[model samples]
Target: MNRPPLDRCTDGLPLPPGDDLDSVGPFVIRCVYALPRDGTDRRLGEDGTISRSLSAMQAWFAAQTGARLRFADEPVRTVRLPETDARIADRGSYVRDRIERLSRRQGFHEPRTLYAVWYDGSSTISCGGGAWPPELRGRVAALYLQGAYDDVVCAEDRFSPDGVAPEINEFKMLHEILHTMGFVPPGAPHHTRAGHVGDNHNDLMYAGDPPWNPSVIDPYHQDYFRTGRTDIPDLARSSFLDPLPAGAEPPPVW
Candidate 1:
């Protein structure tokens, strides 16, 4: 392929483990944190707002996995794949292509990772969300958050007498990230309501309401950080991905 060198094309992270193919190139994990252009009201409670919730979620992820996190403040237009001469045309396709290239390059022989994306537009309706590319049936090692879902409600609002709490935001962040990480596992029955339900939930995956239970943080989430099971399939076995491997020092956390 008449493309840029894979090293030049990548964002300088070590090639994730399973990616041994030069044509597929390096693995990249990008985040797009979309906030309302109108500027969210500063008074909303912590849990009522998406940004606040995302921060807490990111913090939890960072503390658990030691992966450096970055935020994107712009609209998600497209994500160009590494080593390909052409860029992915749309947001959904872009996400799919990236996963494909990463999986093949990283050697995700079984396509274990599952990619899922969610976008929040105006109104209380959680109408605009979609799954990752069908091609990425298994190798979806990571998830991305696309936009804001709703306004943050302040204590003054008649609906919420108390301000939104940080824990609530963390729970919301964890729920969505888990979807992206393929933590729900494949072929599980869907829920008909919202909120965390032990292994199941009437939650966002099933279009349920917010304020998910904090107890949702458990082995499913823990395995990703502690065991590297949550990492891109190719990279899962790499020293970079695993923290406690023999003679391997842990990556520095931010």
Candidate 2:
């Protein structure tokens, strides 16, 4: 969808271009999901539910970090790490190791603390918003209701019986992950009286009242990362994490 022209947020900012994982510090992330044993009865929709949801989540995450998305269809070999680190324990050591490797491969830095937790059933879950400490702010990532779309669909549009379609689930995943990354989209705040503008539905930041298709990427996101601004007021801040040390560079991109 087309987006209105944006003012540049990075003006006069000295941060370097591209994502450097080392600079952002170590992240503690967790991945949790509700899946059927057979994996056959998985919700099916435009993107076949599971794959689309995962892709959308990954896309949102990449946009947040100003990085690109890459996935391995085949099994990934994980390294064994010492269990003494508290950050590593929040997420399994195996998962942490995998994330580190993936971050390095993608030329991104792992957050100081990250968690990807998957959940099943309708449990009202929330991550500490911007109120989270700076040390922990960009360090967490999570995935919930992997196979089920009910919660996400219902949240977007309660009246529709097709509460949680695969596409909707994917969009919700993207939306929440963007939240974790610290980009609060327009229409997110209930009290805000701002009129809807730009690509509201396509963007994770925009409210999904009518429920736009998940496959479409919001141009505002590109504008935010590219020029680092959107018409939305709150997004004007340099919410992205600090830059890498002098002469430090991220590992080669995958």
Encode model 1's per-residue lDDT on 1-254: one tens digit a residue: 00010101122333334322322322222333222323333332223444444455555555544642333332322222243222221233233334444444534332222222222112211212222112122223222222222443212122212323335334443444443333333323331222122332323233333433343333343222234443322112223222323433211110
Model 2: how far residue 161 lies from native, Å = 21
Q: List the global CA lDDT of all models.
A: 0.30, 0.32
Q: Name model 1 segments beyond 4 Å from true.
A: 1-26, 33-55, 62-120, 127-165, 187-211, 220-254
Error of 2 at 104 (Å): 24
What TM-scores do the predictions have?
Answer: 0.35, 0.38
Q: How well does candidate 1 match the true structure in TM-score terms?
A: 0.35
Best lDDT among the predictions, by candidate number: 2
How accurate locally is residue 227 in candidate 1, as Cα lDDT from 0 to 100?
A: 40
TM-score of 2: 0.38
Worst 10 residues of 1 by lDDT: 1-10
Please write out the lDDT profile of model 2 over residues 1-254, one tens digit for every residue: 21111111122322222343544433223333322222332232222334445555555545555543333232212222222223322333122223233333433333333333232212122211111112122332333232122244233321112333334444544444444444443333321112122345554445335544444444544433333333432322332223322232221120
